[model samples]
Target: MENNFAENISPAFSSIYEEYETLSKENYCDIYRRNTIRKHVETYLNPKDTILEINAGSGIDAVYFAKAGYNVLATDIADSAGIYIKNKIKTEGLKNLEFQKCSFTDLSSIENKKFNHIFSNYGGLNCTNNLEEIFSQFNDLLHPKGFVSLVIMPKFYPWEMATFLKGNKNAFRRWKKNGVLANVNNHLIPTFYHSPKQIKRAMGNDFKAVSIKNIGTFYPSLHYNSLHKHPKTINFLMHLDSWINGKSIIPKGIGDYFIITFQKNT
Candidate 1:
């Protein structure tokens, strides 16, 4: 990652890093994101694999993976999140986890070992405009035949677009632009949404596209906070989402986020 990019964006992430855990607890959507990733990851993961988690905000997923027997090096741009993860590791006596303060594009800073899995959950990679350049780092950091699972926001989501009916055109149309300014903890954070095809192009031929599954397909986008009040409806949506995500009949790249997995070609 460029020094200027990190310098400009660090403050925006830092502003929200402290309250991140609290927000995660309050947000049912976040729980959905984590549950979706964990369920998908279990299908392919082995205990011997090592993981490099990018944008590991609060390291929730990292800790979960570590607990499941994979050693995880969780990296985040925010120093506060890194400190919090470190303290959690200490409190829990979790030796399989490591914390690093770094951006997703800056994995080169770590020099010791190559990882078998790289994970970026819930739109972490969407913060940058340089998908092609940033993805080039993956081949170097991961071992041959290694896998990467990315849960990313794409350029289009039907659920989000449904907001237009409610007179929130701005929210509905945010992804129409190449870049949009998001208010994160009162700070303006620039976010860019990428298509599944764009991510595949960025990864290039060295990596084979394994699968792409919809996450927010039948379920409404997380922005509809009011829907959380209906437990029965939310439960039904969760079951529906699970059933529809991996079905090829469902269109790809239309959900709030999609999970795309790839394996480095040996």
Candidate 2:
């Protein structure tokens, strides 16, 4: 069944991925994403800790952590990701960063190893339909009192809803679907959306939420037209977002994504 799904979705996903890779570095959305991940990592991770990053993408965050004195193991299920990350490590001479191809659905291969911090940035965790299974796997991978930080798309995004209301029907419909068939490297990937409450419930009693922040609240999503034409405007929005993002009320559901930090119980 999984193989069939992958085969069906591969072509579309490959094209999507190619486009993503091309725009990732320069896109304002991508820049915000990188900075958000870096901020959370700096807050929770210690210098000597061993960190395991799931869905490491281009391994950019892993390189940052490794450079900061953490031992890093970056994994992604995408075949292209492993080679991309390895080449990056070689080019940068980052000896402390290791690259692997793995999936969140299966951690039996790495279960014996424990990490001081386990992280998945962006919508990596959103790929799974079963949050319980994924959280259980995360629990198994972390040491006692270790941290797990995840960035996921929130179920009710005010900005997205507004975007949709302005006749951006596709944007609105995307969230309404709850689960969508996303293409990744010629593979049709099943993606799930969850509310913050649902995620907390799925983690059960083992993990406790430390903080949750809304990302991209003031700054628009990559698809937003204004961000493309106005550099100064985008920069101004980013600065405003940095100031207002984690406030108790205003920014809660306005962003494109949310970052949630949790700690494994001892």
Candidate 3:
């Protein structure tokens, strides 16, 4: 959480780091991410398990895990977000969480020898085009049979496609390619979208897929701030998402984002 850490990050993400929480502060979509992702993480992790979290934005998920009795090393590329997380950890008097300023591509800075889980939430993994190299490091950082949980933006999503019906064809097919330049915080950065199969192949045979579940399939895009304004309607969609959440691969892979759990076997 050093003030100078911003010098190391790309401009697009630096701008995002500035507006990260402000965009989602009072938004229910943020709550939905917290509830949905936390449930999946808790289901696989036991109390006191150690986790190395990549792109641990503002430490929201890290705090949740600490309160649940897990030790976490929260790593991020942006110092601004890391500083915010550090303050919260201090205010809450949580000793189980530590913040480190580092990108997902480089974990060499981390001193931790091994961890029970290696995690990346939301679309952090999408920011890079080199999954094979990144996943290789993730596997090496874990203990044998340790779990890696990733919440990824799939190559195809209904929400992106929905833009097509609104006459925004370019926006609709942006993710169809393996890589795209996305405008974030008014700066362009390269982003890549990978399908579940592509990710499994990238991870190679050292890991086995445990489970995949749909998230935000029916809950509307997190960008839709008006969801909270219609409590009854949003609640209905939330229930529908819960019912069909893990029922099939079609829904699981086709949602806004999908959770894929893998256990290292080597």
TM-score comparison, 2 vs 3, better candidate: 3
| lDDT of candidates 1 onward, in order | 0.80, 0.75, 0.77
Give Cα distance to truth, residue 16, candidate 1, Å. Answer: 3.1
Which portions of model 3 show Cα errors greater than 4 Å? Answer: 1-11, 14-25, 226-228, 249-251
State which candidate has the highest lDDT.
1
lDDT of 2 by residue, 1-266 (tens): 34444454324333455556656677765776787767876798777899999878777678878888888899877666777779879998988899877777676577557899988887888766678877888777788899988888776666677766578765654465547766565466777676678789999999899988878777777766665698888888777877776556664434777888899988
Q: Give the C-alpha miss distance for residue 184 in model 1, angstroms.
A: 0.8
Error of 1 at 28 (Å): 4.7
Alpha-carbon error at 160 in model 2, in Å? 2.5
Q: Considering TM-score, where higher is better, how would the candidates rank from best to worst?
A: 1, 3, 2
TM-score of decoy 3: 0.89
Candidate 1, residue 154: CA error in Å?
1.1
lDDT of 3 by residue, 1-266 (tens): 11222333445564665455664466656676668888887788877999999988777788888898998999988757677778988999999888888877689767746898998998888877678878878776887789999999886666667767878766555465657666676655566777888888998889999988878777777566655688688878877877777557354577778899999896
- For model 3, name the residue pairs that clash: none
Please write out the lDDT profile of model 1 over residues 1-266, one tens digit for every residue.
23334665666776666565765677676677678778887776787689999988888788888888888999998767777789889988889999988877678997887999989988888878788777888898898889999988887777777777888767555466657766776666667788888899988988999888888877776557789778689879877877876567777887788899999998
